[model samples]
Target: MSAHQPTQHVASYYAASANPGPERPSVSGRVECDVCVVGAGFTGISAALHLAEQGQSVVVLEAARVGFGASGRNGGQLVNSYSRDMDVIEAKYGEETARALGSMAFEGNRIIRDRIAQYGIACDLKEGNVFAACNAKQLEGLREHQALWQRYGHDQLELLEGEAVKREVGSSRYTGALIDHSGGHIHPLNLVLGQAAAFESLGGVIYEQSPVTQLTHGEPVVLTTPGGEVRAQRVVLAGNAYMQGVEPRLESKSMPCGTQIITTEPLDEATARALLPNDMAVEDCNYLLDYYRLTADNRLLYGGGTSYGGQDLASIEAVIRPKLLKTFPQLADIKVDYAWSGNFLLTLNRLPQFGRLNDNVYFAQGYSGHGVTCSHLAGKLIAETMRGESERFDAFAGLPHLPFPGGRLLRVPFSALGAWYYSTRDKLGI
Candidate 1:
């Protein structure tokens, strides 16, 4: 791909099966808006849609297509809470701060469902998800996890053990599991695309292939693109991992890490139902986790493994195939229809970093790995801040953001080493 090549969606299952969407024009001439959002991923679209619904002149600029990043490429699991759960937040921050964050933890899931209903989106929305435990220790951890989530006002949980787990997931690998009835999955690309359409319906303008090349921060922030410039009263940097060169301040505190996914050829209806009996998403309890769920078309979508520093792996299939077989060896003959990778922003503390670059320039990134829900929540919080309801936004903005221990150059190796240590412990059940 050329340095200035026009952006396109990655050749993933989501792209091949995505709903038809218009190819919007890039930024041109001098554009003005109440809010100029950088990046057209989930955060940007969510913010733009919310702002537009409230009758604000919102302009969203995308270097590539909408949902082209991890927003479209993720496991599609609507997992709740932050990458670091509420217990970690309370331990590190305080009970008050944890309470504030926990109150909004499950709100993202609600927002998604509401949008789908209100706008009549067709994203194959399914319900329920399982947290599978691989060992006795991990099983106990699920017990603790359920209790923790219950303490935080999210009580739609059920523990599965013995044959009960097998009824939900045909695999015998899980010693036990926790099912979140409210948690679920969807056709992520369609969800974002539907939201984008809704935003446009509300008079929100989206500029595709328009990467913000230069950002001159001030009261009326100016964002310059190759074709034109946009002046807005406030700006939101929602690029996440793809925002590397656009802003240096965000790059220091976060690192971009790649995750891979594979979708199998459409399986027989019986086989698909057998894999995920109730059609709920499943994620293993491991430092290097494996998440999978059956797509709407009866294909198994499995994903896991991480490549730090956004380096592309030689073969995504090679890394994920064994894990898929380990869970269901009977599917050894199943052909993978698609394989692709996407990058997500990671923070040192495994929490999201939400703050301001200056007075009117705000950004929310570093979802670590639990971005599907948090990114939407981030957008809502950002809009709330702009509407003078900064209490919820301050809960995140007040959290301190520390740079990677070894800086950007060495953050990859350092994080890999830490992952190795934790993964080793997970293996030993320590």
Candidate 2:
């Protein structure tokens, strides 16, 4: 790849099996809109779609092809809450804020499903996801979590203990599990592309390969790009980890960490069902969790491990294969068909950072790891703020997020050190 070569989706199962989509034109000349969204990933496009549907002119600026970032290449689990659970948020903030945030905890998944239904998107959307527990302590934690969520009027949870977990997951690796029937997975890239197309149908425009290099503050924010400039009354920095140096203050609030995944060659129907009989996406409760699910073609997509500062390992398969075998050793002879890594923004407090830099400029990032749903919810909150309804957005903004211990240059190593401690505990099952 050339130094200045435009970015493309990483070679992964999603990219290899991506659905057909029109090659949207790159940004050229001047563009104006009511809201200019930077980053064409889930957050940006989600914001654009919601704004456009409400009769607002929107423009989406993407540095690469759509869904070319973590949004497209994630573990594909549709977890229904933020990275930090509702009870944690309630403890840190208060009941009022938690109530507001919890109420929309599951809306993001609904929006994705609704769009798939409305636009006839063929993303192999599936229902059901499981939160597996690795040890007795984590299992107990899940039991408490299930009860807490019920107090908030969310009772779509079923607890599976020991042998019960084996019925849902073929492996006996887990002590227990919490099955969320409402949660599910999807072809994330296709879900994003479908949303972009739906945005276009609502008169929205998306400019691929157009990355904002500078933001000039004024009446209408002027976002400069190599090929084009976007001028709009309000602007959204939805790039998350990928939005580096665009704004100095915003960059200070989060660290970019890489997570990896690998997909096995297609498995026979009996084998696939035997692994995940219920077809539910599964993620464990380890400090560094292992998440896996059966694909539409019956291949196992397993992912885990974290790299700070977005430094990728020489071979993702080398790092993840051992973990896969430890969980499902029966597949010792199985071939790894695909492996890739993507970065997610992590805040020190483990909660998403949502706020505005100044009037007319909004941003949301640092989902920690629960972005598939929270990012979509962030878009709706941003739209509501632009529409002068700031209550919901303020609820999230009020949640405090601290900058990394050392600034951006040193935060990566500092976070890695902290992660090492937690990972050690996971190893000792402490």
Candidate 3:
């Protein structure tokens, strides 16, 4: 951890390469709206846009700048699904629920692409996402996964074994792989900023540098911010993990865990293509998986290793550099251009929690590190729910969630122990 903490976006490549946008003013006076969505990341921005386009008086209150949180600092891989694969849902919640979840899994990708095209947002969107299998067990899992997702009408999946995997990745590490042609990647920070721009174009209001200090639930929900207050017919707590002390009830339902990433100095186009010839983003199947992809600027963005209990290391470079070298040993001498970490809310159930704290106060969080797509989906669900159409929202709320066994204080220790077991299983190729 740095001696002085970072109150803005972590020192990340995304922050370094963020789009040029005017800084928004903080909330300063009383405001009223049809909907007040806190946190201007993916879920909040998407919800604001959806609600605003529907002619709802939407006001987005962001503690930080647009995409300043995970929306800005993620792996930028659009994996086109939830963190909980359908098979897991099928086994745990039956096919009806699995079908409900699967139907909306890829819709976020559609919304993202649609917004990009409609607004002409320059987010460097790319196509294709490769799922690499690190061992025989993982390869078998991919085989089963291909057939499983196919049963759910996902025909865009193509499984590659042995030489095919090597040919696609330019790496012999993965035994086989599954490439989702329907899935894609993008400059995530730019994507959210674009979404914010789209939200603004729709006449939605956004207040930045305005952290919510208190929430008083009533006929019109009241949000107390440092500079102002907002009373709305509906309120959305979209802050996710960064929402510390904002709402204890929301905080109790999910634990904040962290993931870190490192970006290499930009490579020559030839070298970038050589490393990932197909230009597809890749994520492995390990419990603590490594995700990587080539940037629009020809940089290799590599990241992995999860801190289940959430950790802030003195040097993120020290924690992630070795992880990068392990994946591409030939790049051991490559200059590390940027290193940063961000938190995501982790639920005990691993499924996202979407429900209301009470009537008119809805919340959607705990994507379990799958925020890229699901968060956007949550935004859609929230908008639909706010409009009194809760069918889709109810489907996700149908997934069961339990509070951490020992509550907030002990959740990290409990989770750390569980992570130890699973990550060991990952190392053992189980």
Candidate 4:
């Protein structure tokens, strides 16, 4: 498959309703800083904010506007864990390392909450989330997960039974669930924009519409954009799935997976409460999961369906509407006000990849579906590592990540084949 060009963010509910914020200027002249970060998503902006707070000169370069990528356009679920389960981490690494990583994942959620309060971000924040089980097999898995959380002394998770699940979520399709008070949702674009504003407040510069075209790694790395260049003591590659031609080596490790979402017209208070009694974000346990939550205005923001190939307005709406109706068929009569899609990097191991390409060049990506929280935490760790504290960063960097088997040319086909098998299994109830 050919490399895809960078696409603009679609006119989604988030974009239409985003808070009025100051616009940032594009990079036009040569500049130097202690660190130059690529991509103004959560990871980049968060890193910039942390580094700037340390009194380091920081510059953030974004090919598009802030929150133009997945950071601004996700399901808005701020889950308190990694993309991979703890058991998977333990199986891959040792129990000790897995426990340490798990603790850091929980810390990620705390970081987002603290930032929101500290910065006075106006994103509507809620305090409950549920992982609904679709089948008997999945219900068993939820039970096991609850037990594991208890073993880890994570008492925030409570196992909700059939009736309890229905009480929390108004869906009969889900047999049970794991309710997490630590998990929550927010206006994603607002959160990203707030980070950008905070970063600027801390004396960091953000350059929008400035894509790095080339890089020269050395004692002081050199970054070349169309109209400018930045020479910094350190470089951060936070472009994630939208890296473009920045780093070919990191690009080959993951593929861009497109996910779609749709938002309904605002429902009356009664209808909204009936749809979701507790106002908790609900996500089903499927390889291709269905996640939905109510907006502050009572609109049901439902997300599901993945496009391995590409995404357009019509294609995204077609795949997501039916999934929305399946959970709450009463919404069939309501019109879908907005539909959109975002690209997220998916790794073979379903884990975030965090490490340094070289001692001076650091990179972080591949949060899979759990990026909002992980990306924030990854940014803090990157900041810590820059200050010569690498204990937490080393835990993540120690995780093994294998590059795509077929390289750039054949990786998509290989991934598609594997995804098809999993989708088929999900369909067959196996």
The candidate maximizing TM-score is: 1
- Candidate achieving higher TM-score, 1 or 3: 1
User: What does candidate 2's lDDT look like per residue over 269-309, in tens digits?
Assistant: 99888889989999999888899998889999999999988
Q: In model 3, which regions exceed 4 Å deviation?
A: 1-5
* RMSD (Å) per prediction: 1.2, 1.5, 1.9, 2.0
Regions more than 4 Å wrong, model 1? 1-6
Write candidate 4's Cα lDDT for 1-430 as tens digits.
1124443456889988888887777788889989999989999998988999899999998887898889989999988777788888999898988888877868878888989999998888988899998877788988998887777778898888778787888777887899998899999998988888988888899988788888988978999887889999999999998886788888777878888888999999999999989899988888888999999899999998666633444676778888887888877799889888888988889899999989899999999889999999999999999999999999998888888878777777887788788877766667
Q: What is the lDDT, from 0 to 100, of the residue 304 in candidate 3?
A: 83
True lDDT of residue 117, candidate 4 = 90
For each candidate, what is the lDDT? 0.92, 0.89, 0.87, 0.86
Residue by residue across 1-430, what tens digits does model 1's lDDT show?
1265438999999999999989999988999999999988889999999989778999999988999899999999999998899999999999999999999999999999998999999999999999999999999999999999999888999999877899899998989999999999999999999999999999999999888888998879999998999999999999999976888888888899999999999999889888888999999999999999999899999999999998889999999999999999999999999999999999988999998888799999999999989999999999998999999999999999889888867899999999999899988988
User: Top model by lDDT, which number?
Assistant: 1
| Candidate 1 clashes between residue pairs 3 or more apart in a chain or in different chains | none
Residue 190 in model 1: lDDT: 94
In model 3, the clashing pairs are 1-313, 1-314
Clash count for candidate 4 is: 0
Can you give the TM-score per candidate against the true fold? 0.98, 0.97, 0.97, 0.96
